[model samples]
Target: MPLLAGFATSLSLIIAIGAQNAFVLRQGLRREHVLPVVLTCAVSDAVLISGGIAGLGALLTSSPLALSIAKYGGAAFLFTYAVIAARRAVRPGAMSPADHAPAALRSVVLTCLGFTYLNPHVYLDTVVLLGALANQRGTDGRWIYGLGAVAASFAWFFALGFLARKLGPLFARPRAWQFLDAGIALVMTTLAAWMVLPAH
Candidate 1:
């Protein structure tokens, strides 16, 4: 029961639209660096969830300064990415699955890391919220709950990254890519603005 609860809770949290999911979906559609991107996200989630289960969430609670730094830094990175996406939308190009020139492996990996690490919400959800919930499960069940959460992370990322290829036909057109990038830019810009705005 605890395991299932953990799975459901984690899935509910992660399935929400966010920068990480958007990036993964785009890579999956492009058939570019899907494995690395999926693995990076999954593994990063696993680590964060584990840290939460291990009581690192308390540390985060006690350290507002750390979160503040992440907040500003993440917002800046998101804004930069949003601009790049907007530029792509403006100068639209053919991005067929077969025609894309593969981005360098290093560049892809670094971008994946940025998407994973720079998001303050990732820390808040996986570390503070999930950790608090896991601890509520009591000592014996907490680890089980965490395992379920970890499993959910792996399942979500792999399914999103791999299954996204099925949409290849829809995104084959350059105009489709332009529209998609514009949507991505909009999402990223909104998120960045939200991050920097004063908390009430």
Candidate 2:
């Protein structure tokens, strides 16, 4: 029950549309560095979930300075990416995956890391919220619950990164790519603004 609960909870949180998911979907569609991107996301989630299970969540929640730094840095990064996506939307060129140049593995990996780590919400969701929930299960149950959460992360990323290829036909048109990039730009910009803006 604990395991299922953890999996359900983690999936509910992660399945939301976000910057990381947008990046992963784009990479998958382009057929560029998909494996590395998904692996990076899954592994990062595992590490974060483990840290949460180890009680790092408490430390993170108590550190206002750390959260502040993450908020600003994440907002900046997201804004920069949003600009890039907006440019792509305005000047759409590649209509198909074959026409797109493959990005460098290192650059893609670094961007994946940024998407995973820089977002303050990632910490709050995985470390603090998930941690508090998992710890509520008894000692052994907590670890079991964490395992389930980690499993969900790996499953979701792999599915998203791999299954995205199935939509190749839909994205074959330049207009489709333009629309997709425009949407990504809008989402990234909104998230960045939300991070920087004060809560009501």
Candidate 3:
């Protein structure tokens, strides 16, 4: 019961539309650096979820400085990525999968790291929220619950990154790519704004 609950809860949190998902979809569609990106996301989630199970969530909440640093740093990175996506939208030339040059592995891995770590929400969702939720199962059930959550993470990332190739037909046109990049730019900018703005 705890395992199923954990899987459902973790899937609910992760499967939502977000910057990281958007990036993964884009890369998967392009068929570029998919393995590394998927692995990075899954591993990051595992580490974070483990930390949460270990009670890092409470520690994170009490550390205002750490949260602040993550907030500003993430916002800056998002804004930068937004600009790049916007530029791609304007060009709309390399949108064709056949003509596109694959990005370097090093750069791809770094960007994946940034998207996974720089976002404050990742910590909140994985460590604080999930940790607290898992602990609800008590000591015996907590680790099992956490294992379920970790399994969900692995399943979701791999499916998203690998299964995205099926979208090849839909994204074939340059216009489709333009629209996708435009959407990405919009999402990134909005997230960046949300990061800096005061809560209501």
Candidate 4:
């Protein structure tokens, strides 16, 4: 029951559309460094969830300064990515998934890391929320609960990254790629604004 609860909770949180998901989806569609990107996201989640279960979440929640730093840094990064996406949208010729030169593996990995680590919400969701929930099951059950969350992360990333190729046909058109990039730009910009703007 604890395991199921953990899985459900983690999935619910992760299923939300956000910067990380957008980046993963883009990489998956391009079929460029898909394995590395998926593994990076899944492995990062495992580490974050584990840390949360071990009480890092509590530590993070108590530190306003740390949260602020993440908030600003993440916003800046998201904004920069949004500009890049917007530029791509304007130049549809360069948007073809198959025609463009593949991005360097190092650049892709670094961007993946940025999306994973810079986002304050990632910490709040994985470390603080998941950790607190897991710990509620007590020592013996907490690790089991955490394992379930980890499993969900792996399953979701693999499915999202691998299954995304099925949409290759749809994105074959430059117009479709333009639309996708436009949407990505909107989502990234909105998220960045949300992060920096004062909460209601």
RMSD of each: 1.1, 0.9, 0.8, 0.7
Instruction: Encode model 1's per-residue lDDT on 1-200: one tens digit a residue.
Output: 88999999999999998888999999999989899999999999999999998999999889989999889999999999999889888967654556668998789889989988898899999999999999999999998999999899999999999999999889888888889889999999999999999978
Compared with the true structure, what per-residue lDDT tens digits does model 3 show for residues 1-200?
A: 98988899999999988889999999999999999999999999999999999999999999999999999999999999999999999987867878867899999989999999999999999999999999999999999999999999999999999999998999989989999999999999999999999999
lDDT scores of the candidates, listed in order: 0.91, 0.93, 0.94, 0.94
TM-score of each predicted structure versus truth: 0.97, 0.98, 0.98, 0.98
Model 2 agreement with the true structure over 43-98: per-residue lDDT tens digits: 99999999998999999988999999999999999999999999889977754566
Q: Model 1, residue 164: displacement in angstroms?
A: 0.5
Candidate 3 residue runs with Cα over 4 Å from true position: none
Q: Give the top-scoring candidate (TM-score).
A: 4
